[model samples]
Target: MGVRMRLTTVETVHEEGSWLFTVRDQYGADEEVVLVPCEDGVEAWINRCTHESQRLDTGRGAAMRDGQIICPKHGSMFDSCTGYCDNGEAAETTLPSVDVTVEDGTVYLTDDEVSYLRDGGIDEDEDEDGGPSSTSHLSF
Candidate 1:
C-alpha cells in the first residue's frame, strides 16, 4: 500500500544568507519535521532519524554537528544545502520527502503523503520501506 500524507503548514528559518521556508507535513503533530535547506530548494524529512526516533524527541532538529544537523541518534549527516548525504550511512533509508508545491506564495504538501507524516508509526519489521512505527504511542 502507498503511504498516505498531507501538507500541514509552513515554517521559516533565518539563516545568514537566506530566509527559508519549510513545508511541514501533517504526519507530526507534537513532533517537529526536520528541514534541511538546499540550493535547489529545501529538503524536508520526518525529523525522526531512521536509526532511532530518539533525537527528534530530544529537540535536535536536523542533528547539527559543527553547524551541520547530523542526527544525534545516529550521527547521520545530510547536506544542509541540498539534503543529500554528508556521510551516507543508511543509503536505503531516504530522508523521506513528501510532494510539495508552491502556489500563491504558499507551500502545500500533497494529501497522498500525509499519513506517514502523522505522529503515527508503522511496523518496520513488516515493511522495509515503511517508517518507524508509532502504534505503541498511538495518539489517534
Candidate 2:
C-alpha cells in the first residue's frame, strides 16, 4: 500500500460536486487525481482522459451523466465507479483510478503518492541559479 493522505472533508467534497487533487508518486513525479461523490461513497480517478490524455474536466467540475463521466474533448463516456470506457474512441481503455475513502467525514486518498503541487503548472522562467522557478501564479 502507498501513503495515505487526508484530502478534504466529505461535506466539502459533495458541496463542490468534485475535487481535483494532486499527488507526488514515489519517483517524485506528480499525478493529478479527482474525487467524485458516488452513491456508495466517493470515487477517485486520474484527471486525464484515456483517449488523448486531455484533462477530463479542464479545470471545471467533471461532466457526469447517467452514472458515467463524459470526456469533454472526445465525448467519451467512462463508468464513474469503474473508470471503464465502453464507448467512443477510448473503447477498451480505462481511466486510471486512485483508491480513496471517506472516513469520519474526511476524504482520504490512499495507496498512492500524495503531492499537492503536481498540477501547479510548469515554470519556464529560470531562477538566479539558472533553474526554473515558477513565473506564473499557481492555479488548480
Candidate 3:
C-alpha cells in the first residue's frame, strides 16, 4: 500500500546523530526509516507509533529512560536498542523493525521486514500484528 523509495547513502552522521530515510512502498505510503547509532554497532527502526499510527519523533519518542523511545501520544515505550514496544505501564507489542547492518561506515536498511496481515501484506513487527514500524500500516 506504501511506496518504497530508493535507499540513499548518507556519509556525515555521527555517533549521537540520527539519519532519516524514506521508503515508499507500492501503495504510495512513505515509511520513515531511522538509523540510530548504538553502543552495539547500529540499530534500525521505523518511526511510527504502535497505537494510532502517530509519526514518532526521534527526539520526543525516545527519552533517556534507562535508554528507550517513548510514544508521546499514549506513553507507549519502545526499546530503541531492539525496537521493542513497552508502553509506560506494561510491555504490550512491538512495532515493525528493520534489520540493520553497517559496512564501510554506511548504514543499509535490509530487506528484512515482517508483513502486517491487515495491510494486504506489508511487513509488521513480530510483536504488533497490525501496527507498523512506521506509517506503512496507515498507508495501506
Highest-lDDT candidate: 2
In candidate 2, stretches whose alpha carbon ends up further than 4 angstroms from where it belongs are: 1-3, 113-140
lDDT tens per residue, model 2, 1-140: 65567778777757777777666666887777877767757788887778777666545577777677777666777888788998887888988877876788887767645545543223322245422222223222
Residue 76 miss distance in model 1 (angstroms):
1.5
| Superposed Cα deviation of residue 45, candidate 1 (Å) | 0.5
Q: Lowest summed-lDDT stretch of 10 residues in model 3?
A: 114-123
**Candidate 1 residue-wise lDDT, 1-140, digit = tens:** 34323333233322421121233345554334544445434445555555555333233123344434455444565555444554545434545554555444344544353433333223223336332233222221
Top TM-score hit: 2
TM-score of 1: 0.46
Question: Poorest 10 consecutive residues of model 1 by lDDT?
Answer: 13-22
lDDT of each: 0.41, 0.69, 0.51
Quote the lDDT for 123 in model 2: 30
lDDT for 129 in candidate 3 is 40
* Cα lDDT for residue 68, candidate 1: 45
Please identify model 3 stretches exceeding 4 Å from their true place. Answer: 1-14, 58-65, 112-140
| Candidate 3 lDDT for residue 76 | 66
Winner of 2 and 3 under lDDT: 2
